[model samples]
Target: MHKLDTKLIQLCKKGNEVAQMQVYDKYAQAMFTIACRYLINEEDAKDAMQEGFLKAFVNMDSYKPDATFGAWLKRIIINQCLDVLKKRKIEFSNDEVENLKVVDDDNWDFDNSISKQNILNAIEQLNEKHKIVVQLYLVEGYDHEEISEILEIPIKTSRTHLRRGKLKLQELLKVKYNEARY
Candidate 1:
């Protein structure tokens, strides 16, 4: 943490409202964008972001310097979004993939013709579980272990979902590619 951030955080911990607002102002837009990614409704995303901020403030003592304050707040925001999703009864699968060999494919290469927006649209069409896993892994840059912890599934399940999601995403993109070629 920067010296300025540390000072602000110390003030926030001391229950200074102005300091809290300053911290919120610093991170709100970026955190809101992250919430929007996990939530479809703008209002719901806003609510989640607000709730996340409240939670962070109420639990300010727990904040540590091991990670950047933004990263810590980002986790809280994502967790709040996930809580909203849970209330909607979006099921995250717990199926064990013990027998299945999940290939860890690091390459997320799409054809040159496929735009970033096209890939994002394709990701949206995936099943909810696979979509979330793919979003966390690829878009959010989380490793399998982190994903497994976040989603409360086994590491193999995370890998399996990523593999399956990647395959489906490729298929979706290929169809789009062929259509454009014709």
Candidate 2:
């Protein structure tokens, strides 16, 4: 953390409203974008971001300097978005994956023709559980252990979802690739 950021966080911990606003201003837009990834509705995204900020403020004492402040806030925003999804009854499966043959393919190398936007759109087509796992792993750069902790699922379940989601995403992109070639 920068000296200035550390000072600002200390002020925030002391309940300084101006410092809090400054911190919120610095991170709100980026946090809102993060929330939007999990929430399709702009209103829901905004709500999640605001609620996340509130949670951070309430839990300001727990804000350690182990990670950058933005990363910490991002985690809070993601958790808030997931809480909203849980309220909507989105089931994150806790199924045992002992028998599932999960391929450990870290190869996300899509064809040259597949635009990043195209891949993102295909991710949206995934089932809720798989989509969340894929986004956390691929987009947010979380390892399966971190993902499992965040989603409260087993490490195997996270890998299984990522594998299944990756396969489905490839299948979707292949159709697009074929259409474009025709």
Candidate 3:
């Protein structure tokens, strides 16, 4: 990653075409996959992926290897996807947004029959804030404090979003399964 860290940035900054392609080749599929996870649409995913890369390339000089290049690039793609969703005006209300607490609930059945893809699809259906808070908490395994800092929200807000997101996801999974059975 370090080899790519320096070489890619140096070539990109120098306006090297091959280096640009190299950057695209290495990260496009991965970044696109992540974007697709958010957008749940191939074309929109591609748009976000493209924009993220363009941003990353243009700002390549600002990257430091203190973190993996892939991690940095992935953040860009996620932010791009989030931006698209935000533009759609899907958001949470104040009442729903007020509560933010994370107590381990013994009732969550991780052993349930819900297929991973179904769960992922349900997550994709969430509004941008809920979708991202869910992803950061459950998928990425980030703690509330980390999530709060990352998302620029209060700790309580992070907890609230996570709680609401999980409850919604469970409801979504139940509905989809029941519909399928019928």
Count clashing residue pairs per candidate: 0, 0, 1
What value of lDDT does candidate 3 attain over all alpha carbons? 0.78
> Per-residue alpha-carbon lDDT of model 3 for 30-51, expressed as tens digits?
8888887778779999999999
CA lDDT, candidate 1, residue 43: 96
State the lDDT of candidate 1 residue by residue for 1-182, as single tens digits: 78999999999999999999999999999999989888879999999999999999999999999989999999999989988988889876656667778685699988999999999989889988898889898888899999889878788888988988999999999999999999
Put the candidates in TM-score order, highest first.
2, 1, 3
Top-scoring candidate (lDDT): 2
Residue 43 lDDT in model 2? 99
Measured over all alpha carbons after superposition, the RMSD of each candidate to the real structure, in angstroms, is 1.8, 1.6, 3.4
Q: Compared with the true structure, what per-residue lDDT tens digits does model 2 show for residues 1-182?
A: 78999999999999999999999999989999999999999999999999999999989999999898999999999999999988898877757677888686578999999999999999999999899999999999999999889888788888988988998999999999999998
Native-to-model Cα distance after best TM-score fit, residue 80 in candidate 1, in Å = 0.9
Candidate 1 stretches with Cα past 4 Å from truth are: 95-99
> How many residue pairs clash in model 2?
0
After superposition, candidate 2 runs with Cα above 4 Å error = 94-96
Q: Give candidate 3 regions above 4 Å deviation.
A: 2-5, 96-101, 105-109, 112-115, 125-128, 149-152, 172-182
lDDT of each: 0.90, 0.92, 0.78
